[model samples]
Target: MYNIGIDLGGTNIAVGIVTKEGKVLKKTSVPARAERPFDQIFADMASCIRQLFAETGIKESEIESIGIGTPGCIDTEKGILIFAGNFKYGKNIDYRAEMAKHFDIPVYIGNDANVAALAEVRAGAAKGVKNAIMITLGTGVGGGIIIDGKIFEGAYSAAGELGHIVLISNGEQCSCGRKGCWEAYASVTALVRQTKAAMLANPDSIMNKTPLEQVSGRTAFDAAKKGDKAALAVVDQYQEYITEGLADMINIFSPEVIVVGGGISKEGDYLLNPVREKIKSRVFGIGLLPDRKILPAELGNDAGIIGAAMLHA
Candidate 1:
């Protein structure tokens, strides 16, 4: 009658009872306490699940399975959390086996971004598309690729790392010890850095009114709206960086649709329209194919949870 989806993140763990249609019927959350031992972390997870079932009066027999969307590489076949930047453990945290010990239902695991992409394709922006990519512009750029109505994890479940792709040669350094990574240029981190740099360069820019520590992704857009030349320049440069990465992805996969999500995505059409234009003309062989559509993600944070639940699909 229902499924359970758990979104396990560095700072929080959210559990939800979901319907077959990908609707979250009941949900609860707690601090992730990620620094603790993996077993204790999972004990917290199991406890949260028990609380949700009790509150909703949902029985184990009525549940089809339990799924988790986590931040890191995942071995979907074995339901292991291979490696996560924010997670304390590294390599082969047997999440499925551990969670299964506490529940009778099948347990599955997937990369958080991949599961969110699945949710978008199944019930959000790309609902009817057979192929799509979901890009999240947060502290860093995160992505998920979908093909033929299924999540494409690639061999070793390490594919779809769209952000790590090199965008410039010998360019900005990335957290992954690489240079010119798409993330280093197009992520919110880069945007804020760009905004601050611009503010410092032009002391009279409208952006100067904002504190240096508060130069957010929106600073440029807001100041640009007020006709600040410095701010507008930053917005233009950031958009160009984003477009370059998107064009590369289109050239590689050319998915039928791209769903952009995350904090910066709240800019909506102001962001999608320009990126759409660049991708349309820049992707290889664009003269023969229909324009690939770029749409904002519909499900927001719930995409991961709903998608995790649908892992059994």
Candidate 2:
């Protein structure tokens, strides 16, 4: 049977029809309207689903279940979004219950990061691994851990918060009101912030070519490729911080694989090579290193939808 996957992000909601083998039969996007009322957002999502089915000629009867991947600290059992920094109105939204009532079908809800990890474990980079971790370095760092093919939510259903782990003592400030979080250094937001700070020191750097508002990991990477010494130095510094924190995670969890996700990771070896070198240089247990592969995420943006679909199936 087919499955329906919904990836609800702050900017857009992506819905897909996923086959059992992990192929996407159909997919579409709709504005999340985070600033508007929640009811409107829900209506838009339902409309997107209807439009997708109509365009694809896929009967709802063929679908076995539906799943939603949302950004936040989610109470998976209750299917409620406990808190989300992206969506101001997402607090305590019982999305699964509401969707079930509306569609007359069972619904599963999961954190976006956890859902991506689920996707990787099931069909993507970590496919055959019994233990794995997925880290997405975006606006903020998000992580998920999978052991023996099941999600490892803690007793409070809030485990796998690896990004919040302190990498430095009393260092940079984080959006979560914490100081010295790994995210404060490893996230794309942090990279851009650091780039801008470094740009101020080197006024003639190529980083100045990109407007501050539009500066992203891509811009920084492009500049570094063009022999922009300042940009490359910033990236080196960022990679060092990421390696320091990731070494801790490896020493603690020792997962078989660690899949890196998000826009920065799209740079492939440009990002992965340095991270791997640093992790090996700092962490102990060389045998553990043999089993670990610091791989780029294969599913890209679709991991969330693919994983969310598995939640119900």
Model 2, residue 293: displacement in angstroms?
Answer: 0.4
Q: 1-313 in candidate 1: lDDT tens per residue? A: 9989999888889899999888999988889888888888888888998999899999999999898999887788987877887677567799877887788789988899999999999989999799899999998899999999888999989898899999899999998899999999999999999999999899999899999987788999988878899988998888888888888878888888989999888888887787877666788987798888888999988987899899998
lDDT of 2: 0.85
Regions of model 1 farther than 4 Å from truth: none
Candidate of highest lDDT: 1
lDDT for each of the candidates?
0.88, 0.85
**Where does candidate 1 clash, by residue pair?**
none
Stretches of candidate 2 off by over 4 Å are 211-214, 287-291
